[model samples]
Target: MTTLARLDQFARERKRAWAEGTRRAAKIARERLRSACERAGQRLWRTLSRARHERARDLSKRVQHGQRIVKVGREHGMNVAAATVNLTRKAWRRVRGLRRPFVRAGRRVERLGEQYGALREEWAVERDIESLVDGGEPILFGPWTSEVGYEALYWVAFVRWVKMTYRLRTDRLAVMSRGGVSAWYADITPRYLDIFDRVTPEAFAARTAERLVSAGTAKQMDLSAFDAELVESARRELGVERLRVMHPSLMYRLFRQFWLGHRPLGFLQSHTSFARLTMPAREVRIPDLPAEYVAVKFSGAQSLPPTPDHQRMVRRIVGAVAERYPVVLLDTGMAVDEHGDFGIVRTPRIQSVREYLRPSDNLGVQTGVIAGARGFIGTCGSVAWLAPMLGVDTQAVMTDARFLHAHLHAARWVYRTLDAGRFSPLDLGGFARFGLDVAGASELLADRPS
Candidate 1:
């Protein structure tokens, strides 16, 4: 029974107790960790389920909102369509209401036309030289009165010249222009160019007012009424009972289609007719131009201003020509001043005739200036037309082949040669290198009648 044996047994017992405690603690720790992990998993699953439910609810709400919007849009579209249809129906009904009156008016017009058989016969009468001269005072009628200078000079003046060539008395003739005639045209000689500065309706009303006044019904009158009286007085004074009215537009249309479109017909008929017509007497005195200066005209087509490229090419051409002869730039009165739209500054080396010749300058004076030029260069336009008529040796620069063909007579007879053809780009360097043949230009200038 020794104390050491008893102590050994006690130690073994303590070791066993310690081992059991450790085992128990380890088991408890493992159980706690397992429980915590299970709780965490449950919480995660609940959170995930809530999130999924929220997303589903949000998606459903969005889909419902979209459906509601689509329904509203469809309703709105239907309403707009219904409103449009109703409006269209109302307009159609209104139009139908107006159709009867228009039909009646048309019938009345046709009846009136039928009644005026003699007038139709007279209108159908072909204008011969004898008829034009002895028929009576020639009356020129134009739909557009406010024509550009070139149009007035070429078309209007040409028609007037044609009438004059037939020996029509200029003093007795009356020109009826609808809308106000341009000042450039109004300044032309013979004093028979009467511009009906008002519309046809106004003119008719004025004439009625005049008749009423003459019948002693009205004592006082307005300006328009006075104009009518003046017109009537002039007609009586000129001893013109009925004027042989010439429709310039109709003539021009026919000229373009039949006269200009057909090759030899235009040259033989229109051009030859124009040649036979003597130039109208000009009241405006033309200033003397430079003795040997080259005349250059640069302008664009109707309503369109010359492009920068065009101006630059013209400048280059002028410069090259100026090297040989003094260059004079002729303003067509439709010249567009480039307000430095292009970055390059173009200072024309040649002298501008614009300072001398104004927009209001007489067309005769303008023509005279063109005629006096030694060598003429111009764009394919009215000026080019005039050069041929004047027998001036010229070079015409055309942008389009159609335009050149349309004015074949001018292209052939007017210009000595074509400067640039259709589709020729306005390259300054190219033009500078391909300078105008100095000798050819000189020959043209020398050959031109002073």
Candidate 2:
């Protein structure tokens, strides 16, 4: 070997050894530093562990009644209310997953199961509806087992989608909705079967009570054996041997996710097709109705709770309207649901259609009155949902918005999308709290053609 070659090989070996030692030294230093940090963290954790236990106990006792708390911003100092403390403790107990990890995992599994079940129900309903439409048999749209608002707003719109999507023959479809509201489905079908014709209003009310008792809800979100019986009865009334059914449950199932906050508003838009409804035909007219009358229907229910204050508000509001235009009170003396008629003694200007209403045609009569109204003022549901479709300006009043927010949000959207009548909200709670003048509030109600 050449001398220079030997020298270069030795130099290369020394450089490689130096680099390997440097790497080893760096790795050992890192490991030692990590170990030291771990020890520090352990010491810190131990010190705070006792502190955390005591601090938690301190916090627990601090929020109790009779324990004066430092007031937060924009407030005066005060002791916590006993009820508030109890509610807080109850709320904390409800979050079991916070303390037990497995509880959270179990809850997640349950929620997943619920979602799967809902999806399965939705798919099953879609399949059933498609099958019924495909059978070439007449589709009986309803023994329509829902509120008037839902019927006018969501249910009818959803049915429009069904007709368009399936290319349903108008001749093969008949609506079995109560209240003589065949006019509401003018474009969908001409065959209108009134439930009142087959059954008396008293019998109808009894049947409705049975349905509600069985379902344990005011809304018909599910179709039960009672519903099947009604469908059968309706078919017999139509004198048809075999008729396919399209129940309100279809619309309820389609919009359940949206109502539950799992889906967006667009989900409803995708499923519903809205078209403005023509007025309930002039043939079913209210007798002796003034040309420029304001239709008013106030019920003591969720929106207008049956409180003395609410009653006064109702009277004052009606009085204010009666001054401007002759008032047509759409009051049904019959007991249907939990809601009751807010009894207003009729005057010459303030007249009720109760005398005009039959148990079966009560809602139909109300709808007709509202359709012919120059303007409508009512609790934030029922006929308020209908008046807009009939192109009358609507002023919907509500005290508690807990139940109304979802419907209001959708109603506002539907009104805008369909280019229907103007909808305005009258905050009755605000009026009660802030001493709003009923006369001033009534002044804001929009004017419509007489």
Candidate 3:
């Protein structure tokens, strides 16, 4: 090559190397600074804890004032109530160790991708629940003020039910009490549950399958087809492709046909405007814990696989882990009426422990709703998942056929859906007859064959 070309190449190499070195130095410096700040914060927290202890009586009164917000509007028949849990010393200790570090780590790592960041955030929240209790009395933590926060509370209770209900005759159970609802839930769950699978293109059109054929004027579309139409309409209306992608579901597809189309009487055929249509509330109510209930809720654990078999294995372990701890809490939402009569609030005020920062703003309101129970029962969804991580005993419920691997990974009392569906038979004598033995199932799950 010519001398000029060689000189240019060497100059470019020097510039690139300098830029790379500068970026590396900057990254290392930022990380160190972040760490230093966290250390300082922790030290300050310790100092404040000491100061708060000295003025415990006065501070308790102030806390009570904040707590009183829970009871407001309850008698107004608003169908929503505010509540929180009182964390035990042990529970507080556990949470303090995990929360801040987890958050900081998650924020730093999120540049990698949305899924990884989301998982980290969930993990941090789970850690908050784990660091709160010592296996007995409920650790109260919420000031569930908003609809969204209440939803998170409800999810905790629902997951608790999922875990504890598996071995009803058993003395103890565990559940989740914190974390956000997963998008994976929307993608999964439908394969098995009728509630999810029953949704069809006809339902989207506000017409029954029988009615679709008779009403020849009405257009029908498959899910994918409907998505295409919706995408075009969204692009036309918003002048961008991003808008089409932003709206995740087909709820908007019908919205466009009825509102944006040329038809003036679109409301007459619109799904939402239909006279008989009733959209089910997305979230369920959290049930109240019964006086006789001896339940435990745990959090702070990382979720395992996303496959079916691995999840069932996790559930099997949950049931066994919960055997040692009687009371459990969970973070799972239940579907309840918007009027709020069904879930964990069957009775008057009774204190329970909640263990997380009120992250209602992060997750939508009504993320997790649950109904009240005789005692606390749960499995990992929100709060209960964190419990075992904090060293609580949990009896996790496992199902072999779950779609998302995460749920199965968190299950303890593993149930084989194939066995439940008569694929795995107790006897070969009759093809139509299949017997299920819960104890045997438990035993099989417990046996980790090497």
* Alpha-carbon TM-score of each model against the true structure: 0.44, 0.73, 0.20
Ranking by lDDT: 2, 1, 3
Number of the top candidate by lDDT?
2
Residue 208 in candidate 1, Cα distance off native in Å: 27
lDDT of each: 0.46, 0.76, 0.31
Off by over 4 Å in 3: 1-20, 23-377, 404-434, 439-450
Separately for all candidates shown, the number of backbone clashes (residues 3 or more apart, or on different chains) is 0, 0, 104
User: Please, what are the lDDT tens digits per residue for candidate 2 over residues 1-450?
Assistant: 899999999989988996797688668857865775576557555545645565556456645522432333115533467546755665566444234444444565566567667766776777677668875677888878567778887888888899999888788888887777777888888888777777676676677787788877767777766578778887887788898888888888778787777777887888888888775435555678897788898887687797988888788778878877899898888776667788987998899888877766777777778888888888888878888878888888888988777788888998997788889877778876887666566555524323
The sequence of per-residue lDDT tens digits that candidate 3 reaches over residues 268-381 is 122211111111222333244332333423222122223444334334433642343222233223221111111122112222333321332112222221212222223333
Q: What are the runs in model 1 whose C-alpha is more than 4 Å off?
A: 1-138, 141-167, 174-244, 259-272, 276-289, 302-305, 332-349, 410-450
Give the per-residue lDDT of model 1 (tens digit) for 106-142. Answer: 5654644443443233233333333444544545433
The number of residue pairs in model 3 that clash at the backbone is 104
